[model samples]
Target: MFADVSGPSFIFWPVGCGDTTTVVVSDTEVVQIDINDKLMADEEGNEHIPIVDELVAKLPQRDGKPYLSCFILTHPDLDHCRGFADLLERVMIGEIWHTPRIFREYEDEKNLSDDAIAFRKEAHRRAERCIEEGGDPGAGDRVRIIGYSELFEPGERYEGFPTNQFYTRPGNAITVLDGADVSDRLHAFIHAPFKDGLADDRNETSLAMRLIIGSEGNTLRGLFLGDLSYPTLMQIFEQTHAHENNSMLEWNVLLSPHHCSKKAMYEDGLLQQDVMDEFADSQLSPGYIVASSNEFPHANSAGDNPPHRKARNRYEEIVNDAFLCTGEVSTPEQVQPIIVSITANGIELDIKDYKLSESAEATLTAAIAKARGNSAPPAYKVGFGAE
Candidate 1:
């Protein structure tokens, strides 16, 4: 994703029209948030993106396995969890940070999207396996249920089990869980998927996380609002003020919510000043805005908030520094991820020539050898012949 970020970096994958972000927290701990991996091919049998392969190759590995400190599902949308099954089978996940909605659906046998169902199965399996064993479930077996939902009432889902034992709520500043620190460099503020905010639209249930990269006076803040709508964003702004949580609002790099959706910024084809005021108020000087979508500044596109043409322009105006999109930054041939990192002055996109380092190459080889010896399978490709 990045050209070997020695420090901290957030890699926004260039997967068309979807979201898959890998926060390279450090050399050791890496957190993958959401995944949008759909197989697409051309008449010439050329595949667009071999997402799993790229992820496996790009993500750091140790010993004989590719490892992820945490795999956070912002929300169980198909775009977010499409390749999760393969990821679980392949990568060594330390722990999972997921909302309670998915588990609730799994327990109730509700009509869930196919991808959601797949993730639910794995999450349940891992959780059950952890519960059977003693103490904390190491790595892959561990789970952290983020945000307590009314869906999981007493004698309800996973009845008789202490579900709240692992439930982390909004405003929680989580660093370490299950004997593993998800990030050493970033201070994550869980801002959304609030208990009261849960409604019908899955988008509103998105787990919004604001990441701060420094401490004290010198800090680089970034917010990841997962598919939240305009009203929700307003609510976050209002609550942040009401509670006097300055850290939650201040961000040098703001990942444009809902893929530069007007619904996150505009209302009824008009820019909401109240919300824009929030952006203007909290945005640090020399701010950077990154939209994880394709063909940004899509003025004509409608229905969905993603790639809203006006939204992109609005973000550009709001930041007044750098406003970039995943699709527009990288070339179509070999779509490299958009890497935003903390800089000396402020946050900037760490766009560089990304090639596997010699160390990383060795790790890959070792992982391959180990997997081969164990007769373990690699992560599956999104499409045929992509690998």
Candidate 2:
């Protein structure tokens, strides 16, 4: 029993770094950008988090057919694709959109740890299964990597395919998925890691997307910057400015890039005068800036986990309203996962109001507290094995 919503959009769950962002477009289609750690009960009566499990649980149950329409992997990073293999087996995927980079063989994947290797093997096995099942693996089930240039052709019509195409090239050097009308509404826009040069690894080539739903009349816009660094983000801004005024494209909601790491906004590994001013200005563009990080006041040895006190102060000074972190900002000790729901109208995110389960809530809380003091946060829970 969910409310009937129109205009096609809504983010189902916005868990911090550890969890995945399941974007449900309308009620009919489901698209997951990345699958982090999956929380579940494992064998031996132990609680094992299998990255994809947590994500699937959040999704509404599908009848008999696979409910998942697509799986978009930003890059080949383990944290990004770890859960993809398991997900493919459990659900019926219409298409799999990814970059051109793929593993040469199973040995090449051996470079990863033992656990990492297992995940990679599973992904390959499932991919093979899709082939044996007679589901068009090339463009039908498995699609090759696509860049922005592929979709954007100066004056020519792209012949954009809505569903049948399954996977398509990134448009305008970007990939944007606006939800279709249904029970669960979600919209996403891919932004960063602009292809300036080709590289062997895909992390530098991660496909970042900005997701939001609420503003249709151009009054408000929510934005999410996924695991993107400052140089990459600035590159996008520069390119956009070259085409048109910065005001032409702006967001009302923003997900702090790179978990709001100081490195994201700093130069020479230090926050600089000009960079600070630019970031402050960017914060003003959106009505709200949502930080998706377990790191609170200070998690790293450098000091704070996400933003240092000084930087947070700078954000407050410019934005006037103050920045919002995922966990409780009031106390450094108290920690809990905060799920945010956004729309064109406004944002509704409160830690206390919602409850998933006691244990689930406890795990999130403990992780946040532990990450705040540790120099390095826990490793990301996603993985993408050899192709």
Candidate 3:
């Protein structure tokens, strides 16, 4: 079904102030990058969207199983891997991309969140089981070590586990799924979580990458940064420039690290002028700076965690009107997913909603009208919860 579609798309789900991106490589193969499905009770708990349901529905089937080519956990933060163990129970993951520092529970286990611990445990079980059986394993059973931090030396891996792996440290590169085409629509380039910048914080160990999507001669690049800090991002930019790896740095779509956290853009309260200048210098004509969090920071209020106003200004200053926040577009009440399709010409927000029962022709028509950015209120249904 996806084969008919002309280009690759990224459907960023609305999960409050958290992140859950569905990278649709093709109609069939898919990747779920970070998940946050905190349960909500009508009485006491805040209303939260159950994203796993949507992820399972979107994945292409393989031998009757809901098949996800990969499930990448950028880092071990709670917002990144909240319902990961639960998602594993639902679908078959191809391979997991992560770093070793995620396993380190420092300072009496204060470094790792409960969700991170759960995800790490699940990763070990699957990788170990696959090795003991002495055969090729499913996606969930596979773990690809993207980068290592200061806590680990080169070639050091999970404790007591000689499982299958694809270790691509910072400054190195890895093909998407070992050059295994999800649908001939896209490929990936790993970038961050370098050995030199490894610190006790998990955000600094974020596994950043660039998703280059499209056919030959029409590819578009989407840079994905997972909660990377300010100084580290600056360092990465400088290093990439020095090595002449400019292609990896260019972005048609940049997911502002840490959900537009000021900490990633500002030193203390002062804006990093050099960083902002560099960002301004690296636009790919049709670029978009997407903040994957609840309503982006407004000019007035100063927030603690992320979605900071100062960070939003940085993106807005660089990308102009192309800046869009997942929460702002989706709004806070409903938590709608933002689908941006990358075509040969450029990237545009997908007008056609991901309705299971919609006619293809009708969906296409709606998508076109919506792309114009002046369509009336969406009348289509969004069936998101109830997993």
Query: Each model's TM-score?
Result: 0.82, 0.64, 0.80
Candidate 2, residue 346: lDDT: 49
lDDT by residue (tens digit), candidate 1, 68-186: 88889988876677777777777888888888777654444355555566778877776676556634656667777777666445665444333544557887777774465445456
Q: What is the lDDT of residue 351 in candidate 1?
A: 61
Alpha-carbon shift of residue 297 in model 2 (angstroms): 4.3
Better of 2 and 3 by TM-score: 3
- Give per-residue lDDT, candidate 1, residue 142: 79
Stretches of model 3 off by over 4 angstroms after superposition? 1-6, 39-48, 106-114, 129-138, 149-165, 176-184, 300-303, 332-335, 344-346, 351-387
Question: What do the candidate models score in CA lDDT, each in turn?
Answer: 0.69, 0.46, 0.66
RMSD of each: 6.8, 7.8, 8.3
- Kindly list the per-residue Cα lDDT of model 2 for residues 1-387, writing each as its tens digit: 111222233332333343244444545555666554533221212122333444444444557534566676665555455556567666666555554344332356445633345444544443454436444443224442344433323442222322232333332322333222321233444454455524524445666554444334433344544555556656666665686645423555555554556655666666555544554555434355555444355434564445455445544555634466653331233323333444455444434433334444556555545555664634533334322
Model 2: CA > 4 A from native: 1-19, 38-54, 102-107, 113-189, 200-202, 212-215, 218-220, 245-249, 272-286, 297-300, 303-322, 327-337, 342-346, 357-387
**Model 3 over residues 1-387: C-alpha lDDT tens digits?**
232244577777666666788776766667788997643223212223457665555467888877888888887667778777768888877788777665554434444555666677776666565456554454557677677643334554434344334556678665547226443566677778777656646677788888876666666677888888888888788888998987778877788888888887788678788887777777687778888776654564654667788788777877944888776665323335567776656677662333432232233334444545643432311111111
Error of 2 at 138 (Å): 11
